[model samples]
Target chain A: MFLNETQEEVRNTTRNFVNAVIRPAAEALDREERFPSEIYEEMGKLGLFGIAVPEDLGGPGFDTLTYAVVMEELSRGYASIADQCGLVELISTLLVRHGTPEQQKMLPDVMSMKRKVAYCITEPEAGTDVSGIRTTAVKDGDGWVLNGGKIWIHNAPVADTGFVLARTDKEAGNRGMSIFIVDLHAKGVERGPKEHKMGQRASQVGALGFSEVRLGPNALLGEMNRGFHMMMSVLDKGRVGIAALAVGIGQAGLEAAVDYAGTRKQFGKQISEFQGVQWLLADMAKDIEAARLLVYSAAMKIDRGLDATRSCSMAKCFAGDMAVARTADAVQVFGGSGYIRGFEVERLYRDAKITQIYEGTNQIQRMIIARELLRKGATS
Target chain B: MKILVPVKRVVDYNVRVRVRPDGSGVDLNHVKMSMNPFDEIALEEAVRLREKGIATEIVAVSIGVPQAKDTLRTALAMGADRAILVKSGDDVSQDLEPLSVARILAKVVATEKPELVIAGKQAIDNDMNATGQMLAALLGWGQGTFASAVRIDEGSALVTREIDGGLQTIRLKLPAVVTTDLRLNEPRYVALPAIMKAKKKPLEELALADLGVDTRPHLTVVSATEPRQRQAGVKIQSVDELLSKLKNEAGVI
Candidate 1:
C-alpha cells in the first residue's frame, strides 16, 4: 500500500506498455504459439529487465517490490510474456549476486534481451528432489564436460545461454552439485522438440540435451559443490515472482467474471443479480486481495534484505491455489461461453493452471512452508 | 539558443470526468492528474530541437499548485534540462486561468530571456486556447498557433500551422511563441531509468509574489453544468414517416 513514487511510476509504465503493446498481440501469439521476440526486445529497451538490478550494472536498481509489480502488470496482459521476464530476472539476479567479473559482463545483453538464458535445474528424473539430478559436469582439461539432459526447461528452444546445475561430485548428494553457464549453441548440445502444453503456449518450452558439452573454466557460476544452496536462494525470489504471476492471473479472471456476469442475461436478468453468482464473485475478490497482500509482503521482505524463504513459499502456495480456483470459478461465471475459445477467460483458465504446477508445484510449496513452520515454531 | 516550454497538469485523458452535482465544477478528488497531452507534444518538439543541436538549453515552466511539481518532473524526465514551478497556492483557483498563466509566464520570459517559447495550443481542462497568444502579446513578439511543424535557422523560425481552411506557414523572429497542435509529433515513453535520473535535475519553485505578477481572474465561471443528455431515437416506419418527422418534429425540411 505504501509503494513509493518510483515504484508507482514503474507500475504505471509497465501497465501502459502492457495495454498498448502486449494485449493486442497476446491472443495471436497464443494462437500461433509464437514467441513475441520484438516485444521482449522492446521491453529490454524500456529497461523493464533492469528493474531489480543496480543502476551501474545497466539496470534501474529497483527493489524486489518493483520487480513484483512489473511481473503482475505484465502478466495481466499475458502470462507467457511475464514468464519470460521472470526467467530473465531469475538469471540476472543470480549473476548480479554471485557471478564473477567475466560472468557479470553478460548483464547488459541479458537485460536487453539480446541474449536469453534459461534456468536448468529440473532434469528428467529430478522434479522435486534436487539430489536426484544426474546431470554430471565432470572436470575435463581446463574445462568441464556436461553429459545429462534437463526437461521442462522454460525458454530452452530460444535460449542462448543456460544457468545449469550439474553433479560435480557424485558422493556429496545435493551438495555435490555445481552450477555452470552453458552455451546452448555449443557442440554436443541438442534441443529436443518443443513440449506441447495446455496453456502458456506462447512460451518456448523444451528439453535440452548435453552430450559432453564442453564449458570453459570461467563458465562455473557461484561455487562448485554449492549450486544447491545458490539455487535454493534463487528459488526463494522465484517463488515471489510466481506469486505475483498468480495474482495477475487471478485478477484477470475476477475482472472477466464480473464483466461477463454483469452483461450476460440468464433467467430474465443479468446473472450478476443472482445470490450464487454474487457469492462466487465476492469470494474470488476476497481471495485475490489476500493473495496480493501475501505476495507483496514477501516481496517487501526480500527488498528489505530480510530472509523470505518461508513467506515466499506461503505466498506462492496461496496465490497459486487462488489462481487455479478463481479461474475455474470465472469459467463457471461465463457458463457455456467460458468453455469456448475466443473468450479471454477461456485462455486465462488454461494459463492459470500452470501457476500451481510449475515453480515448485503447490505441493512442494506446502512442504517448504510446513518445514519452515516446524523449524521456527510458528513465529507468525 | 534557449527554449522555454510551459506545461499544465490536467486530468488524465483516460479518466471519465464527472461534473459536480452542485454545479460548482468537475470533481477532482482522488482523480489521476497528468501532463496535458498537447504539452507533451510541445515538449517533444523542444526536446527534438535540443537533440538536433539547434537549441543549447531547454527550460520547462509550470504554473499551478504545489502538486504541479510532478508535471514538471515528468518534463525533466522527458529530457528538459531544468524546470521552474510558479506556485499559485491552493486557494487561488482563478490564478490558473489562461490570462493569469500568461502573465506569470511573461514574467518568466522576461527574466529567463529564452529565444523561443513553446506551449500547448490549449489545456485539456479549460480548452481556452489563449495562453500562447497572450504571452506573445504581453512580450510584444510574433506568435504561431496550432503549429504542426517548426524549422529554425539563425534568428528566424518557420512554423507550419494547421488552420480551418488548410495549412498556413509563418516566419517569426528569433524570440517567438509557438503552440503545438495534435499532429506536431509523438512523445516518447519516459523510461524508469530516465525518471530516476530526472530526480537529480534542477527543479526550482517560486511563488507568484516573487515573480511580481498579479494572478487575479480575468474570467468567471458563474456556474458549471453538464451537457444535456440526448433522448433515445425512434425508428421510422417508412420514407413518408421520415419526411413527416423531419418536417414537423425536427424542422429540418
Candidate 2:
C-alpha cells in the first residue's frame, strides 16, 4: 500500500522470479551448502544486483526504496540470496560515490556477477569495534604492502576481488584506515576453508589472509584514511537492506504458518479455526506489516536526502527482533512438523537469527538509536 | 510483419471473487487486478515471433479503465514495441461486453492495419470467448481459435488448434485473428532493466468515443451469486460401513 506503481511493478516481478526460481531451490541450496551460481547468474541478468548504481554504469539506477523492496522479495525466497544482493549494493555504492572512473570500470562486471566481490571489514579482533582492527597497509613507494587476516568474510572463498579495510597510519586511529581493492588471486593471498553455519548455509563464508600482498598504485579507493567514514556513510542503507531482509523472513514464515494452519486439521477441524492458532497467525501478520512499514519509511527517508540514521537503526533492530520472535511462532503453529529439517519454518527461524547479528547487531542498533536520540534530542 | 496483441486486465486469478450482495456483479472493491493469463500467453507468442525475426513490430492494445495502462506497461516490458489504451470506462466493476470490444478492435484494425491479430481465447472474468471470432467476422478474415501453436509462412499462417478430442491444423490468410489457448506459450518474466526501459516506450491513449464504437452493454446481468460451498463429508470406518453409507445416505451404490 505504501509503494508507488513502479515500486509495485518491481515487487511483482521480483516476487515472481523469487517464487519460481529461488524459493524452490532454497531447500536444496541449504541442504547442499553450495553456492547457486545459476541463480545468481539469472539474477544478474535481471538487474537484481547493484540496484542503486546508475544506468550509465550498467545498473538499473533505482533508488533506496526500490532496493529495499527488491531485498525483501529476494529474502522472502532465500535470505542468502538477499545477503548477496546487499553485499553488492554496499560495494557498488562505495564505487559510485568514491572510486575513480578507471576503478569504476568494473561496475558492469560487478553488477553482472562476472566479478564476485567481498567486503572485508570484520576481523578476528574487530567485530563490532572498528578501532580494534589490526590489518595494516604500509605505504611503500607508489604502492602499499598489505598484511592482515579477516574472519567471517562473506564470499571470501570464491570472490575474485576484495575491498580490504586496513590501517594506513598507526597513530591516526579511525582516520588511519584506508580501503584498497585487492585481487584475491594475487600472490601471498590465502583463502581459508568455508565455514559451516546454522543458516544461510548457501553463502560461502571464510577467512582471508593477506601476507605482505603487493598492491599497485591504483589499489587505493577514494581519499586515503577516509575508509571508516566512507563505510559509515553506507551503513544506513545497509541497515535498511538487512531490515528488509528480516521482514522478508518474517513474511515467509507468516505465509507458511497461515497456509499450514488452514490445511492441517486438529480435533476434526482446521487449526486456523482455533483461537490459539489464530492469535499466533494474527500476531505474525501485524508485526510483519509493522516491520515492513518501518523498512519502507527508512528507505524513503534515505531516498529523500534526510538524516536516516535513527530510522534505519530502529528498522533494523525492531525487524530483526520481530523476525526471530514471529518465526518462532510460525514454528509453534507447525507443531512437530515445524521442527523437522525440511520444513521451511525451521530454516526460516534459523535464517532469522543472522539478521539480528549481522549488519550491526540488534544491540549495536539500539546503541546507535540511543546515541542519535541523545545527540539530536529524542523529539527531533 | 506487424502483429497486434489484444490484452485485458482482469481480476487476478488467485483472488477468491465474491458476488455483490445486491446481485449486481462481483465485488471489485480493493481487489487485485492483473493481466489475464491467456492474454499474457497471447502476448508471449507475439514476442516469440518478434524474437524469431518473423514480426517487425508488436502493438499491445487494451480496453479498460486507466489502470489497464499498468498491464500495457507489463506488455511492453515483455517485449511489445508499443501500446494503445482505449479508455472504455472509469468504473473498475463494469466490463465491456465482447461484442463492443470486438467492434472497437475492428476500428483499431482499420487504422493500425496489422498483418496479424492475436488475442486471448477468453477473459477469465466473463468467459466470453467471442472477441476474436467476432473481430474476424467483422473484418471478413479467416480466424483460428484455441491455437496451441502458430507459425507464419510467406503469406498464410499455420495454426494448431486444440479441438474437443484432438488437435486440428488450420491455415489462415494474413490479417487473420488467432486466439491463444493454455498450451500456446509461457510468458517470460519482466526483467527490472526491461521495465525501466519500457517506461520510455510509446504508450498512446485514446478515449472510447474516439474509436466511434458503441460500448453500451448489449446484455444485462440479471443476478450474480457465489458458488455454494461443498458440505463436509463423513469418514467411513470399514468397508461394510462405507457400502452401507453409500447405499443408504449417498444412494450412489
A119 in model 2: Cα distance from truth in Å? 0.9
Candidate 1, residues B1-253, lDDT tens digits: the string is 9999999988889887888778777888788888899999999999999999999899999988888888898899888999999888874233377778889999999889999999999989879999999999999999999999999977999999999999999999979999999999988777778878888999999988887777776677778888888885899889999999999999999
After superposing candidate 1, which stretches have Cα over 4 Å from the reference?
A258-278, B91-95, B228-253
Candidate that would win on TM-score: 2
Ten contiguous residues with the weakest lDDT in model 2 chain A:
A52-61
List model 1 lDDT by residue over A1-380, tens digit each. Answer: 46876677777778888888987787888888998989998999888775778888888888888889889889989999999889989899899989998899999999999998999999878998878999999899999999999999999999999999999999998789989999999999999999888998899999999997989989999988999998888788898998999899888889889988998887899999999999999999999999989999999888788879889999999998999899999999999989998788888889998999888989998998899899988977
TM-score of chain B of each: 0.92, 0.93
In order of listing, the candidates' clash counts read 0, 0
Query: Candidate 1 clashing pairs?
Result: none
